[model samples]
Target: MSYLKCSGMCQLIGGLLLLLLAGCSAGESKFLAGNLNAVNHTSAAINHFSVNGYGGGNVSPFGDGGGMCCVMLPRQWLPGLKLKVEWETDPNPNVRLPALGTDAYRAAYAKHKANYQQHSTIVDLPSYETESLCSLKVHFLSCNQIKLTTACMAYGQPGYPIKEPQVMKEPAVCPK
Candidate 1:
């Protein structure tokens, strides 16, 4: 019985070590590539390429390394998505991950408020950004937008409003 316990402990330690080793051996510079398209107020479609998935955080400045969340536009005049990326290391900081006023959240909150109103109980209302793009566009939707909100609200993950990757204003060790 003692031998079995010892072997089990050893196996657990070995598994943990292997996981650590794999993490270390895997380099940190992984890229996330995608294409983004947006229709402007004029009803013209614009396309942009996106990259820069690693090394984003609160400390990442606007022009240093990749941002925690950045969305670059391919053209100089194309409008980008309106998003807020927030994170907290604290055990409890009351930051609304999907910041107030997301379309999905609003819809949910509206339903919740309606149910509460029927009961005559005053549930605290959620605050939201009135100027969000949803207010301007009648029909704009993306599966990612909702998914991102759910992930952030549930897991406190940060969002990266990345622009399409572009040539570095200054060149250095760029890919050929």
Candidate 2:
């Protein structure tokens, strides 16, 4: 009887210790990942965007692209969290791709490449209200401005925190 009692007590203590460890181990990541969404508010087109090496879809001006799955974020928001954003944009969104493996393709490709521009910056993540993250929304604004939101609601939905204008204004002079 005493042996059985001791075993039960030991098991309970061990279980309690494990729970304590798990709670503290939530360091840096309890890791809830969500879909990546690109929202564009510029006259140009966002060819691509990435958050800390996680690739997302392209978006058109005043529009949003399809969601890209699985951008890992800490389950709980911590102050001062930031991410590196790298993106490519095209001034002319309507450019047609020339047929591959031809002389026209090479020349057109060069021109297309010349028209494209790249941007990279470290952006502070906007605060979120919930532990359950919905999407990592990357907003590309005019004059090479970028904003990030992990808001639980979708863009343009009621109570979605990222405010947008009816008609976006592009900058007359962009920074070099």
lDDT of each: 0.27, 0.83
Clash-forming residue pairs, model 2: none
lDDT of 1 at 16: 97
Worst 10 residues of 2 by lDDT: 1-10
lDDT of 2 by residue, 1-176 (tens): 66556577788999999999998886556778889998888878888889998899888777887479979887777889999999998888877877998999999989888989999999997777676778898888878888888876777889877787624788678776
lDDT of 1 by residue, 20-98 (tens): 9999888643322222222111111111112222223221111121222333222212234333322211211222444
What are the per-model C-alpha RMSD values against the true structure?
20.6, 5.9
Task: Name the lDDT of candidate 2.
Answer: 0.83
Which lDDT value does model 1 have at 29? Answer: 30
TM-score per model over all chains: 0.17, 0.76
